[model samples]
Target: MNNEQRLLLLEKAKQFFRDEIVESHITRACAKAGKLSNYNVNPFLFKYLANFLKGNDDPRSIAEALVLPRVLGSSINTSFGMRIQKLISELFEGFGSTTPGIDIEFIDAIDGSKKYCQLKSGPNTINHDDVETIFGHFQGTINLGRTNNLNIGINDMIVGVIYGEEIELSSHYKRINERYPVIIGKSFWHRLTGKDDFYFELIDAVGDVALEVDGTKVLEETIDALSIEIEAKFS
Candidate 1:
């Protein structure tokens, strides 16, 4: 569907669940969640309803629960940017997808640069014990030794990039020698999921991107656009 069509569909879907219903769901959800101030009301309520109405239920329910606030904040009623940012920050720090049950340290140790950059922001340390707070979340971990040793050359680094919901891209460094040896290792693992599929790439030293995940070139522009969005948001 086109962008407009998709938007319209989302709006229509959102309209199916009015504010009253959402509010009611939130009330019940808050009670069920009980004193969890940082709890995501939308997802909680969505899952609750999904438990009752089990058919073709997707993340749309959760998305719809967000629409009202999104609209209100987008309108002249309020500046939802900060609130949205706060929610996102909490979601990531408290319940980000990177590590579902186990929280990883989001340290400001490096940037896009391949050097020991000063830690501008403090690291967010998460431990394994904090997983049960969120019911459904998972993530994978890559085990690379502490030493700068690897089966591959120091310059040769294999990496996996996860995009959107479930889109994962695995590729090796094209120019390992030209870049620093940074190992994206996992100290722990968590259960996390996504909607988008993964794209695996084996990057050679010559900067060539080889599709390692199912050899197929889908909409390259779409992927480029998605990456641009991630960079813009993360940068």
Candidate 2:
């Protein structure tokens, strides 16, 4: 990528982190968390587990249980994943896709070929049903392309995982890769921007944005809310 394009991409990346990560961090992090009513607590299990505790007492363990997993769960992942699909579409100047399995159709920046990509946030994001859905959509697209006299081929189809290496991918992704090309991490970014260094550059931009944006207020509020629930139950 040229200097101008690099600058624009960096600006977009910063804005995305602000909106998706910083702005949504509050609600997204505590979506199913904070309030006791929001989660189903297994006091029996906690009691059993906390029985084995020495310095770590029951109340503290319960409090941690009430907050940690709920905050760390897939709420943020799902929202950020959806936003990533939109951002990637924009970055590639992609067209809105009519194909069911495809997110967007765009000219490959590096090779100048038409690419139909099914975008995922990470390697292990998909499951068995998703596997069926992707295959069904891909096959349907192929049949339609043939009928329409299009030049679409298996090589034109791509499964794009925004992060992770092939060896570390889950079974679902490995299965998908068996049928179609899987581009991920640096390779995925390189294909889009035609720069070997674009991946590292984007990572640097993400790090800079993280350093600039503050989410302490949201985090504090979430902790306060969770603490209230903990006190009510433990007191």
Candidate 3:
């Protein structure tokens, strides 16, 4: 696609993400947590939203770093990670399932086979123990499938880590690779979007959104609402 077309597409994607993914999920979480109706106006939310609305680079290492995971929790890392994971799944248009052992489960339209996906936010976010735990679940799925004479097996699983360097698995963990290999960084993005630069393009789109005049106004409004909510809730 041409530059203009790409930008337009990105804008649409941004809007979808903001409305369908981000806003919807945040609204539910805030309601459940009994926060302000517009609690999403906080700094962490604003930073990422403003960056996307204005198309600027995210100031924080992780976009949602400042948002709290729990009402009283200090960090929003987990929340941010979950959002990213959901965004990726949305980008791929995959079916999200809360299956016991997998984060997402979908049918490969080409092969007519089911695929289970496990997502991690960063490279080092997963360790030996994490792999083992997931593998145990995977094994359970396979065993159950076999006992029931189902078609599911090792070939149907994929593990993806979103950011950071590739994982260096030791010999013990390497066996896991035989059944379900972990994909990271470029490989992961390429597998999902068929474009190695998809990640960079997304970052650029976010920056571009942050640069828009209308985007700035939205940020200001969010901040105003947030400020009012904070005063009413805490004071």
TM-score per prediction, in order, is 0.15, 0.87, 0.52
TM-score of 2: 0.87
Clash counts per candidate, in order, are 27, 0, 13
Candidate 3: segments with Cα more than 4 A from true spot: 1-9, 16-76, 106-114, 167-179, 210-235
Q: How much does candidate 1 score in TM-score?
A: 0.15
Please, what are the lDDT tens digits per residue for candidate 1 over residues 1-235? 2446434433432332333223333333323222223234554465556444444334443333333333323321222221322322332344333322323323222231111111001011112342222212211122232233523222222121111111111222222213423232121001111111101110121012112222112223223333343334333
lDDT of the candidates, in the order given: 0.26, 0.75, 0.56
Q: Alpha carbon lDDT of residue 93, candidate 3?
A: 52
- Measured with C-alpha atoms, the lDDT of residue 137 in candidate 2 is 82
Give the worst 10-residue stretch by lDDT in candidate 2: 49-58
| Model 1: residues with Cα > 4 Å off, grouped in runs | 2-4, 16-21, 33-164, 167-235
Q: What is candidate 3's CA lDDT for residue 22?
A: 45
RMSD of 3: 9.7
- Top candidate when judged by lDDT against the true structure: 2
- Highest-TM-score candidate: 2
Instruction: Rate residue 171 of model 2 by lDDT.
Output: 89
